[model samples]
Target: MAKSPLFERGMVTRRAVLGDKHVDGATARKTDFDDDFQTLITEGAWGSVWSRPGLPRRERSLLTLALLAALGHEEEFAMHVRATANTGATAEDIKEALLHVAIYAGVPAANAAFRIAKQELAKLQEAAE
Candidate 1:
């Protein structure tokens, strides 16, 4: 089947935020059973929503990080935290977003997110050195 325009657009956006290596790793591990699900995220989440022009990528990154933190989606939150480098979301922005998560989503969740974010940020910094 021909690839959808949304899928194509999503791949571009996804690679931009998540980086080529991360996206490639996921693609490389994709199985037949996950094909449909992967398409849905690429088209719906990355393409339809993230590709919208209304919000800046930085703002979107903050929102995504906050929501992931609130929901205690540790893994996804960590991934998005790393994505902030490309999304233009600074560490300060993440700190502020997690403060919101603390007030609304509870201290424990925000605390956990802070830990993950710190770890990811350290790894990123280490990579740069």
Candidate 2:
């Protein structure tokens, strides 16, 4: 089937935010079983929502991190934390977002997110050095 326009837009925005390496890896690992799932998020989340010009990528990054942490999605949270580099979100920004999560979402959730964020941030740091 031909790709939807939203999916196309999402692919471009997703690559811009997540980087080629990550997107390439994900595409490389795509299986028939998960292709539809990937497309759904690409179109719905990345294309339709992220493609909007109102919010800067930096704000979206922080919001994504908070939502992931609040929802206890450790893996995606870590991924978005890594995406901060491309989004212009600093470590300090992440810390503040997680602090809000601690208050609104509960401390335990934020605590786990903090651990994951630290690990991901360290990995990015090491790669830079």
Candidate 3:
């Protein structure tokens, strides 16, 4: 099937934010079982919301970190933490967002997110070295 324009836009946006390596790995891992689901997110999340110009990618990165943390999506939160490299969000920005999670979403959630963020950030720093 021909990919839609939205999906094409989403592919560009997703590659911009997540990098080619990660997206390539995801594409490689896709199977018939999850292919549709993958396409959905590529089009929906990356195309519709993330492609919007209303907010900069930096702010969107922070918001996504907060929501993922609050919802206890640890793996996804950590991935976004790493994605900060491409999104222009700093560790300080992530700290502030997690602090809000502590206040509004509860300390426990923020606490776990902090742990994951710290680990991921350290890995990023190490990779940069």
| Residue lDDT tens for model 2, 48-115 | 99999899999999999999999999889989999998999999999999999999999999999999
Candidate 2, pairs of clashing residues: none
Compared with the true structure, what per-residue lDDT tens digits does model 3 show for residues 27-100?
99999999999999999999999999999999999999999999999999988998999999999999999999
Candidate 3 runs further than 4 Å off: none
* Top candidate (TM-score): 3
| Model 1 alpha-carbon drift over 4 Å, by segment | none
**TM-score (all chains, Cα) for each model:** 0.98, 0.96, 0.99
Against the reference, the lDDT scores of all candidates come to: 0.96, 0.96, 0.96
Residue 9 shift from truth in candidate 1, angstroms: 0.6
**What is the clash count for each candidate, in the order shown?**
0, 0, 0
Top-lDDT structure, candidate number: 3
Where does the lowest 10-residue lDDT sum fall in candidate 2? Answer: 73-82
RMSD of each: 0.6, 0.9, 0.5
Tens digit per residue, CA lDDT, model 1, 1-129: 987999999999999999999999999999999999999999999999999999999999999999999999999999999998899999999999999999998999999999999999999889879
Q: What C-alpha lDDT does candidate 3 achieve relative to the native structure?
A: 0.96
